[model samples]
Target: MRTNGDLNNTSAAREVARIDIDAAHSYRSLAISEAEDDATIRKSYRPFLLSPEITSTDWISKLELSTVVKLAEEDLHKTGERLKVLVLYGSLRERSYSRLLAFEASRILFRLGCDVRVFDPTGLPMKDDVQHNQPKVQELRDLGRLERRPCLGLCRATWESHCRLQKPNRLDPPLRRLRRPTQGRTLAIAQVSGGSQSFNAVNSLRLLGRWMRMFVIPNQSSVPMAYTQFTDERLADPVEGGSRMIPSGNRMRIVDCMEEFVKYTILMRPHFALFGDRCSEREERVEKERKATEKARKEAEEKRVE
Candidate 1:
């Protein structure tokens, strides 16, 4: 008794019901999977401790420490001196991923017994507009002179082939004046990308470090889709089933990079003074001075003969 239109309506209703049922089943599966992940995490809970001699772990809460590295008596620095690290970020955003990453790095470096200093670039002026007496500029330059190791955290913007200009690039003009005097100092680079993982920013930072006469460390970190990687101001642990398929899943990469940086700094600190002692450059300067002296002597002799 039903027309063709009524048949079509009945079929559409059945299709809608089927879709609803499937959606409910998908939601239930997702919930169960999340619960399993949580349970696994609880069962495998471990603290992340870098040094075995750590007596107090009151400062560590979020970072899960499992590995304990014990240094031999000969391997330890006899001076008991701590490595000084300077951390700089390129962004000024309130919720800047670069800043967050820098903070995370500072935490790791501190736990490793390094004196970490995070430079705030707020109120810093551009290179052209900067004055020598400016407080922020002086602070940055002082830190540059004092700290032997620098770690840069850069923010990658949306652009084709390259990222946009960053605020920290302004630091080059002042630091460049140091020239070869600051050569052989260690540098570490880290970057955060808003979209996918990209090294454009870190690559650019490497070039900058080279220009500044710093030795950029071999290990670098480029975090992808930074927004999802952080939870409650801390990097989310993405390790499930003891695997880190996602590049930015584990913060251990950053920890490893920092460890390498500290090692490099220790290795090169004793040889820093030797970097500026280039025999060739010094000889060239001496030759120029000798030529100038000879020319002046010739001029004086001609005047006496006349």
Candidate 2:
């Protein structure tokens, strides 16, 4: 997670340079243990990084990359704050298409001057499998709670390969336990399908966002025939190409969705309090406090009169 030295490196390298700082620094430096070191090095424990790179075409052309930077900078200039974004993707396949797409969106967000963290759900336990203190579970909760503001959450939720082969939903189990952190967050959904284009996954994600009290954006991306969407040879040989997970044709839509997502998050930043304030919850708390005060005063008056 060396952030400072390698601006000129390939696009893939630049992306990996932005792994979540918290994930990298989770363990203390003064105390070293073999188990801790193993966890840090394992692919699942740390935030995802691109596999080693080889010389290849840039995932994004220099011109396009510059345009994205300029537009994002212009739009976000007034805020004067770096947006904190958390990306969550489903699927644990070695080459999950959802992960690839998440990485692509992360790059755009990073260029937009966002402090982005992608939660790796690989080893995450089921909701009942363990307590909140489980390492992976804690990592995700920490990321979700990174900012109380309505910062952006780019979620790529997916079903099985092509159809209704329902495996345990990777995100829902973990996120159900994360309602506190997710409340008032802004979410953008994307889904990948192995066959034809389908909104099933994204639609389900939208429902989940609603249940979580998140601001789900209107714009979304669904890539059909996803297996063909990414370059194969490039991803397989880490040394032969820049990165295989780079999306080929659906790049424009993905970028557009991310742009809208970022802009909406910026637009909503000023009203975080408005979004977070729950009238019913606040009223209930106030009622309880009032009752307690009344009881206390009655007891004091009775004792004094006696």
Candidate 3:
């Protein structure tokens, strides 16, 4: 959560730096809560100077156990290596609940024989900050390039004049040019702190993924009152649930979503897309040429009639 200053310096005023404003649409900070916050507040920040310890649970619920077994049955084509995944989280608070959830998901994924990597969003300038080839950007790109052709991130979504993911994010299109790393890859979303359990952010991501030609998986997860959903090391059990229950409420949704992602990846492996979006771009060019040719024919026909 320490976006600007050293984690050791807890008292420093090293808050997030000046954000580059997006010119297309003007934003005004309306309701900045000393106690509550929203995405519109471009500079809204919380100080989480400590890293959270992700707890592991060996006790699997019957629901989770059954889901895993069913997934295994569907994964007859186990490609022999752990599936690789990349997780991105939004917010810089040292104890970002979303980060905790992402980490918890990573632990579960790792236990499920996944080769997982979680990106620290620190120094990740907004997509509008610079070109897509910037060091941090390239690192993200490369991660999506290798053996694992999918990129998944934990993101904070917002609702303003309309619905969209958090501003100044990595998925900005102008910076990426033609080589979109997410193109032809698998994607899924998990949101946190949806006071109303809104899936707006994930829905926006789904649209953007399709625009980039990504094979975004249909399943996604969103946690309402996300804080109530986790503890120091793992997801929290329902506050009102019976005794001896697992501390995982909405956490199972994450499992369900990821399980679906794995199965779809295997099922679509052979006919997977080629990255860089060249194929889509090529289609656009062909469409334009067809229109132009039709116009020429129409003009010729008009001349002959005259």
Candidate 4:
């Protein structure tokens, strides 16, 4: 039903043909949805937003769609309001490419009809350096609560906040890290640097995403030698030539990853998320902890009586 090119375009695979720059759509602001904010998102620090990741010569040229692309396109037809997405980036540089990539993903997601929120990982203390009471730490925790099912997004940077969500192994409170960063929500990760590889940050994110029980989208982006691909105002398409996974001229990876994420969030929300059985592992662990607490309480009572 789909051609190899279409498959390549959709999946997280690298290799294959190069898209003609002349034919590629000029980067445009996401105007595909009209959803407004339900909750107020006032912040003290201003977020940096780059309009066009790359300038386009024409406004109408397009990239060939993958089947996955069609799925993402289909999500736009839903009748409800836009999905809320929170994007987190990992860098703190003056001219951070990861930050720029966050802007790029946000714009595309905006075009796809999602109410996106980008979290700047600045001023937040390390996961170990500060207690959870700090305002910034509290902000991260409050934002990460998955009860509302908003996409808790992240870019390149420290995993301190994500790590906080991890409950200690056996002795750790099973429910202490209550917010399920990955469960019942949509998430995506992206990174960019002047160098040609920054997979470590994203790879770490994947580990955290899984540990947090999140449904992380399969496709991801890591723009290496990023300076070559981005101009002052826009992120230029990758030039053809690179390893298998990291394709050159792979600007579309961001779109592919985000589209898949939106598709999963919308399509799978009901089927995969809503009707799920509580994890047996968690239940068993909770029961064990309850027993331990009861035993400890009884022992303390006996000592007091003695």
Looking at candidate 1, the ten consecutive residues that score lowest on lDDT are 24-33
C-alpha lDDT score of every prediction, in listed order: 0.57, 0.64, 0.52, 0.53
Return the TM-score for candidate 2, rounded to 2 decimals: 0.71
Q: Could you tell me the lDDT of residue 288 within candidate 2?
A: 100
Ranking of candidates on TM-score, top first: 2, 1, 4, 3
Worst 10 residues of 3 by lDDT: 46-55
Please report the candidate that would top lDDT against the real structure. Answer: 2
Cα lDDT tens digits for candidate 4, 222-266: 676766665544433343111112224547777677767777777
On TM-score, who's better, 2 or 3? 2
Misplaced by over 4 Å in model 1 are 1-77, 146-162, 233-250, 285-306
lDDT of 3 by residue, 1-306 (tens): 667767677677677876444332121111122344333321322221112221222332222434443443344335543455666666677566667666555555544444456665676676564455667676656655634444432222222113445643543443245245445566666766536677776777677667766677878777776656644434434332111213465767776776676666555554555445377789999999999999999999999999
Local accuracy of candidate 2 as per-residue lDDT tens digits, 7-50: 77665553445423343222211111235334533344334334
lDDT per residue as tens, model 1, 100-121: 6676676565555555566667
Error of 4 at 81 (Å): 3.3
List clash counts for every candidate, in order: 7, 1, 10, 11
Clashes in predicted model 3: 10
Model 2 clash pairs?
235-244
RMSD of each: 18.1, 12.9, 20.0, 10.2
TM-score of each: 0.62, 0.71, 0.57, 0.60
Residue pairs with colliding backbones in model 1 are: 47-64, 47-65, 47-66, 48-64, 48-65, 48-66, 49-65
